[model samples]
Target: MDKSLNTEQVSVEPQEKRAAKPVDRPFLAMLGMLIGGFVGMLSETSLNIALPSLIAELHVSIGTMQWLVTGYMLVIGIVLPMSSLLQRIFSTRSLILFALCDFIVGAVISAVAPNFAILLIGRMIQGIATGLILPLMFTVATLIFPPYKLGAAMGMIGLVIMFAPAVGPTLAGMILGLLSWHWIFWLFIPFLVVAFILAAKFLPNVGDISKPKIDWLSIILSAIGFGGLVAGVNLASDSGWGSPAVIGTLVVSLLVLAWYIRRQLASKTPILNFRVFKKSQFTTGSILVMLDFAIILSSMYLLPMFWQNGLAIPVALTGIVMLPGGIVNAIVSAVAGRFSDTISTKLLTTLGFGITIVGLILLLLASSTSPMWYVILAHIVIMMGVPLAMSPAQTFGLGALDQQTSGDGSTIMNTFQQIIGAMATAIATSLLAFGSSAAGNVSHRIAFTNGVHVGLWFTLIVAIAALLLSLTIKGQKWA
Candidate 1:
């Protein structure tokens, strides 16, 4: 975006020395991306707060209103697999500016829509924008920054990812308390508009852009594979996992995904490159990322319900209580990023998962008699551990790639993160339902707490797996 450095070219090689240009404006580009990412993550979590209000105002049943969230996720899942292809077709500046504007348009449309159909359409459009921009943010940062500084820059991006959801519900609750549900969409416009303006003037091209031919077969398979997989998992939380819809969708999705994987491996120009997995650090790091995200997402899903039901905490108060943990998460994500460059990331990841295990133990030990501070402390500890492990894992994975496949690597990581998040939440939901059902003759609150413990135990096991994987990293540097 900064035309002043037109003659200066930055190499894709992380270790390659730059022929240092004085006028390059990479931070401005990153700032715009950070803003765009914040808006996207905020859009993700904030809307749940407004769902009940929107249902009442729109005269829709509870099930229909949830489509606003589920459909948004579905569309995003479909689009994410095509991100590398999209990057090849559009320049960084052009692509990001378009996504920012698209987000703004969707926000405006959702804010003014008078019916459920239009609102759903608007939310889906916003979904597409996020699917395009999120991977690009990672890809751009990977290509632009040198390896030495890249860790801190990735940590800053991690802040946007972790902090937005942390505060989004609180912000939305406060907003809805005073204004109409429409204000939620209205607020997104300003943030995204600022992102668009900054990106237009400063975002520079990173990778070589080639207008590759669209592979329609790959696109269709991916949509059905990813979209169906996400949809099935999402529905499982409400519809029992045994429900025909869930079972059928999951079966069809897995089969299609198998076919899709085979096609990608054989294709010369695959829409989603599966080849990135050949790099062991990238594969190992990605598994760590998925495991960490699942732990975080499942805990986040279960903890609020645990508080509200078992401890009799109010819904609003639960968000307030969670605020401290979010703050700690933001700080740790930033610090961990900088530390990754100087420390052994494998050690950092091992430490992070270790801390997470302690937090989970604290949480499992607490019950109806546990003090509120204990609950908050447990959350804060997990928050610290997750991003501490997550950021470095992310850095380690992307650092393994050459510039040619950075977009593919980023897209692959992002797409898996989403599916893992959904699956974790759904699995937690099922465990709670089953565990509570088995808590024979107990009080409702006690029964639910029993279910919560079961879920926490599952996450604890995953955290241990991640810890073991971190050890296998052997302190090896990727590049």
Candidate 2:
């Protein structure tokens, strides 16, 4: 069977493609996407170290500074629901190539950004590419590779995503150590150009090309609903949560999202499989994943600002301190599945959150006067805790679905995690802003650390909530 359309009978098979191409061509087919994924995720995490500097140079408050991250995520969240529709409408090669070019333009705009508005505009533009590329990577792999090679390809894709975060901070650190933050954006151009070249050369046009009815309603609801909620929460710090703007947006967002859920449940071909929530195991597991994601992103947002802006730690040193955690996280994640086979998902998950709780406590106790050991040890512990829980919990969640909806299960998981992660960071900014205000008449470092403690307390509460959910996870995934 031809690898391109063997199992995919939805479209006619490619007529006269390179039947005698290199056997490794499938790997080549995936190379552009893998590099693109790496660049996207790497840019995501690497910027945490740059946030403090950006805030200082850009003349923005903590609340405004967060748009740099949350805005990027928000755009991705809106784009995810439209991915299925997009995959059917455009060929994989065209979508990816366009996204890469879009990313390069965004990078250039960001590199020369003279102010916060331009910088945010650049980041949001870059986000469109990440959002498009993310789903396409998996879709392309599932398309070009036969079943026997599927697992390895997926694992490699997952690893590259993981590996970027592992290396992103350190590399960004080294670059920032020698140069300004603008260089961070500049660094992507060379790699992206190479990826664009490989993609143009090796990527076969994959996926169905039929124009499905554009589900404008689902897309609109998803965008407005998720976007409004994040915007509301993001606004709450500068404007109190009681402010009409915050309250109004939050209420309207919830109402719209409820309608969106109802519409999806009733549709014959819902874009998202909200029905996956019917399985208790999947629901429990998803909450765990989202919470763990929240924990990770909240920390990523806080720690960089806390260390640099609050405690006066240098950018390079801060990245170096967090480096061990990232490396350990990737290693533990790689092996977490094997251990899940031996240990029950319930116990592994509970234990992982238990460990995470301890880490959060360690961080909670840290302040401006804390030693370097405190930050390093606490970060590594938190890092260790997340993968320990996330991998098995995700496996256990996705396992509960009937094979038919398993794809939906994965899509739901990814979509919510992105929204939740963005929300958590915005909330952290709110807490930080409130804490700083509440701590009037303090030194800058002391004020910043105090605000971080407030955010840490909130993270601790989230971890506890996750731990409680972990305890409820039954051995039987269906229940």
Candidate 3:
């Protein structure tokens, strides 16, 4: 056996030993993590609704102001692949505290920001917190919860993850209705404080602290590689694929990522283990999870635009129309988690994709004259499909790993999610632009509706691919 593999196994033994014995107050620990995770995720999409308001208040162009969202996502993607390394280095309790502190401080900075630069800085800081909290929540859940209960636990975690983005626009819409844009940051303050308190009180020191040799080269490579890749893809929608900036960045990103992968494979003590892919189940699950996230994000991106821009619904009303679907998504996510514990993920995921395809077809059929009720029903159906597929697929994927590799598995899963989200959004945007351009001289509403349909069709193709993949999932449950 390889010496580094031996060392890795030895390092995990202590963690497993600790986890084998039940800790006091597991539920509180989970709650603390969930609260922090929820608040962090909520902050991600919440700002979307507030962007227009911010544009007017800050006197910035939409292109420049988008960095608040883009930069935040970019920072999260850069930091996510480092999570397993951090997990191995820091105790769970210490890491949780650091993440919460980062989040709270960032929120303060954002709330008081007098300019876009400072606001962008604050958002990046908060992104660091989100990147840490999400994977940590999954890793900690696997460590603390017994296998029998993991589905439900991860399901609840899914609820927070999926639900937060779902409700973000609605919440932001509500906040902006009554308060200024700054208050959006302020709204998170109370939630962050509560989460911080809970975490300080209940989050446990679950993982073993093995101070492995830090690989600066790997760190640098990942920062440039993943960062460059996501940035390139994001810029494609605006810069066009053939633009030198886009092409150059992408070329550099690909070369650096290739080098990074080579280095990881050669290093006995790789910062992020690629060996996790040696498990076929993990790979399948990871792909499925990525597809599911892409579907969710792409739909989320298209629908609101379709409602507000195509149908001429007000921003606040668009949010209100989508609220029921978000609520249903949360409920289904929780239930699906419990069901995965008793049922086959293959069945659940297939059914999910089928329902989602139906919803997408409905969405594609929608016209400018479509009733509000029809749109609402279509959104609800698609939203329902996401949780049905997401929670089980996630639980099944991460659960396949041994306790030792859970951190690495979780990190890989989440890192891909962020990357996929950025790419999907970019692709969806490009398609929309293409579709609009093709509809020459049409009314703006009609042009935008055409774009929306094109995007939905693209999403449908991906969902069909995911459904087919889900059918091929062989294991009935986690091995």
- The candidate maximizing lDDT is 3
lDDT of 1 by residue, 1-22 (tens): 5654553444343336441221
Candidate structures ordered by TM-score, highest first: 3, 1, 2
For candidate 2, the TM-score is 0.86
State the lDDT of candidate 2 residue by residue for 82-151, as single tens digits.
7766766888789899999999999999999999999899999998888888777756655565543444
Whole-structure CA lDDT of model 2: 0.79
TM-score of each: 0.88, 0.86, 0.92
Error of 3 at 115 (Å): 3.4
Question: What stretches of model 2 exceed 4 Å from their correct place?
Answer: 1-31, 138-167, 198-206, 337-343, 402-404, 476-479
**Model 1 root-mean-square deviation:** 5.0
Please provide, for model 3 over 356-421, each residue's C-alpha lDDT reduced to its tens digit, 9 standing for 90 to 100.
Answer: 999999999999889999999999999899889988889888877988888889988998888787
Q: Which ten residues in a row have the lowest lDDT in candidate 2?
A: 13-22
Cα RMSD (Å) between model 2 and the true structure?
Answer: 5.8
The 10-residue segment with the lowest total lDDT in model 1: 14-23
